[model samples]
Target: MPINADYKYIAAEIEFQKAETGAQKMKALRNMLSTAPTHKGAERLRADIKRRIAQLKDEIVKTKKQGKGRSFAIKREGAAQIVFIGLPNSGKSTLLSKLSSKKIKVADYEFTTTKPEVASIKFENIWLQAIEVPAVHEGYAEHKQGRQFLAIVRSADFVVVVVKEFRDIAKIQAELKKANILLRKTKEMIRFEQHMPHMVITWKDFNKKNLVRELWKAQHKIRVQTRAGHKIAPKPIVLQEGATVETVAKTIHKDMIRKFRFAKVRGPSAAFKDQQVGLEHVLKDTDIVEVFMK
Candidate 1:
């Protein structure tokens, strides 16, 4: 059916199309449908729009019946947010109970975790936040609140999943993939090329055990120096290892990592003074690095 071409209505259409989740998109459509002009000329078009809205509402209700749970919207906390996601009875809650003192409900039945819970995992100087998301069952996979739960996972800095021997990680991966979340990866970083940028680029091959250290180091501050031997009083830009030439980027934007045509490094990770490196070179802690755009 044809929607009104008014500027305000067009904006609403854009919002609906751009919405990432089904619930969010449905809400957007309803809001747009409300602005329909109440003239006889627009009656049929408006009626069609209302019918579509009703169908969306029905779909949402049917999905909720499959997996009944309250909508969840948890604010991210700590240095990094990692979560446990798996099939029902996959031990997500049990794993969280063992990791921290937080008392979580643990049960042998599927969908025991009625809600998401967070716990802290202390690693030396840093504390990593771990969350246990309620189990997902094939039957309840389309529940309205499932989008909200998956939203939490999508915003997470890392993912730590629990699974049984028979649990299909592939299926789990497919479900989470719909949320634009990654199950496995080795690298995450920001790329800089003078004026233009390629947005925040991530690489492959990440391990979960060292994530605490990896997250800490990748999100910490870096002390940067210029190519002219001019000390700019480094402000600590956080970046990960093996940044090679342009390694001093930040994930949190606490500081800026200048990208030059070439960079020089002088530290234990380097073989000699002012050793030139590429963006693929790994960096070491407390290393002295210099950048040049000219």
Candidate 2:
């Protein structure tokens, strides 16, 4: 198809090129398409612009559905939510099935998995959830589903960039960067600093140890088992080391602190076996605590 010679369309094309986010580029494209002359030269441009707009709308809808707490079901509830992203047929499905018990469809073809699939994986004692999303490819960002898929990626606690070959890595990485979901380390990756608060990278590689040791430094976690039940919840509750029993109660439930009386403890944080401690007692990792309201 021949290109449009209109200057207004040219300006819109420039705006689209300068746009950072997919949404922005899409909007620019729409504006440019409308101003473009309906000459034979701009025939393909109109179709391309319409397709781009539709894709952008779809992406916006997908992201909103996930964010609005609707059918997306990709919410973060466990210790952390890890998402796997890569080009189609890049072994993401295989890796997800290997890491998690959840059964997700995998095929040798492209675009087998279209929606986000959730599964739980164990990291030592910690339980981290994994989400597998649609495969991304060239012009994927131009697809509405592609943008929608990125919305899902944004909510992840950590990101796994799947790659079958080495060269393909750069393409996915650059795409992620444009969406503000950086894969590279920023200031917040630092654990010892304790002062840098604004770390914005959305995706990270999975650690072999199973445990996301990086998440630990971000939020010190401990398993608080109910003495009555003799075990902690599926995932450990996140808290600071100095946080007390009352603090944990508040975390588990808002009314827990008010209904709380005294708690018994066993494990590293306690001084004695089944020690009767007050609400202010500090907790430690793997601490077994029983709260009594009655």
Candidate 3:
């Protein structure tokens, strides 16, 4: 306390006492510093206030750094990572549970999920990672952990905007736009374009099967099964759209490209059954191929 401190200084002291978070304490300490006494007698007191303010600032910075590291840390698994964002109680948890069969905390109240909840969503022979992020609100980008959360969203392979009402989509979009995350779609299909992540707005049609189908479509990837004689591999090789035999060979092993002679196709991309095609042949979804080496 400064000697002959006025009401403003006293008010700041009260605010400091009531502050709950480091950021709040920093604000109150700043006010205290401004109204602090400037006389020789109060020099020591002012120095102490300055020291406290500096310490608070350092702590806040350190806490934000640690938070960013922890909050945005998500290990990408499966074929792709898709994150779901919406306002609180917007069926995000329900959708996650239905799609992934993972039990998530579902409540009628708000902010039930304060952090990211992740699960694996299987689409036929392929799997995708789904994460439910905390609700987005106005000024979300300015919130303490909002930036970190948005960073995680931005790094996702795709984003699904879950909303309770159709109009609420704009609110989530606004928050995402604040972080430069733009939503792109083609017809009813949305996908990643340029450097931006792909996104889809869904308020209805929470069907698990359809959702998985759309998610796989948006990724623009195809599943190709390899065949050796009459036996076909159980797990299919997932590849991007417009992928060719060369691409598939390269995916199996880099050395296959050099030793490759030709591939026998059996499904969608095949002109005829067991069609012999060169490495430049384009493949399609669910195409069964068998590479024959010279």
Candidate 4:
């Protein structure tokens, strides 16, 4: 059959995959797999895409479940989950041994960690929960054993993939690709825009000026969109005449909201001009603030 339309659809699907998130990516991948050309050359690619879509769907479901249970799991007296992933004999047990008091079996063989093990680590006032998962082999996902093991890895909030220097780099890359996970080398600062939603931009180094510049530009764009009567869903900057710092922090992240100690306000509001005030202080419009936490 003629495949020009199918090719176009596949190209669109690739673009959608780059831009969409969660459920949207899954939907686009499914559409592409279903509509791909049936020629022999396209068949393999279609199958690969279908497999990826299925994997992404599984991840989405797993992530949703994790989200629902995260608070309960973390607040269970003292608990936090850090999942370790790596190939066989990758020093997972050694690391776990050093971090926590849990006695996990350490062996110089494959599949040593057949079952998940949880351990508790204390650092100052912070308590962390660590989970060591089984070693995933090459092409493990294609088999039943590997699939079941990976489901555990997918539920982790923080994933640690262990690799040795002597191992084949290609093999490690392949495993990561199959697992649909990437190692983040550096942390990125969270940016909140006026009209646009929040964004994460990777940076090589910390440059406060550059960061503020980007935020300012995003705020300008939001103002323009708002003035044009467009709906903007960016983080809300609410400023009532007598709004407390607690209320403002509540509108942000809830975890540190209650721990707010003081706020330094800026912008057009003169009452809070260069003044540090407690959580009970009321706020005004155009007030930029830096909240201090305990």
The lDDT per prediction is: 0.57, 0.65, 0.78, 0.52
Cα lDDT of model 3 by residue, 1-294, tens digit: 332555465446645764667877889889988887888877887898899988988988888888754546877667778988889888888888988979999998988998889999999887898998899988999886888898888788788877767788778778877887766667654444444455545646766787689888888789888776666767677788999999877765445677777899989898899999999999999998887765
Residue-wise C-alpha lDDT for candidate 2, range 1-294, written one tens digit per residue: 232234354446545654555567777878877887788756776787788888888988887788753445455645666677888888878777867778789898999998888888765666777788888777766777777788777765566667766678678867766565555545444111222221222225444343344444444456555544444444345455687888766654344566666888888987888898888898987787766653
lDDT of 2 at 62: 85
lDDT winner between 2 and 4, please give it: 2
* Per-residue alpha-carbon lDDT of candidate 1 for residues 122-233, written as tens digits (9 for 90 to 100): 6553456778787766633466677788777666665655566423566776675665544453244321112111111111223335544554554443333222244432
- Measured over all alpha carbons after superposition, the RMSD of each candidate to the real structure, in angstroms, is 16.7, 21.3, 22.3, 20.7
Query: Where does candidate 3 stray beyond 4 Å?
Result: 1-71, 184-186, 189-203
Over 4 Å off in model 2, which ranges?
Answer: 1-79, 122-127, 165-167, 186-220, 229-243, 252-262, 275-282, 292-294
TM-score of candidate 3 relative to the true fold: 0.71
Candidate 1: residue 221 Cα off by (Å): 11
In terms of lDDT, the poorest run of 10 residues in model 1 is: 192-201
What TM-score does prediction 2 earn? 0.56
What TM-score would each prediction reach against the true structure? 0.45, 0.56, 0.71, 0.40
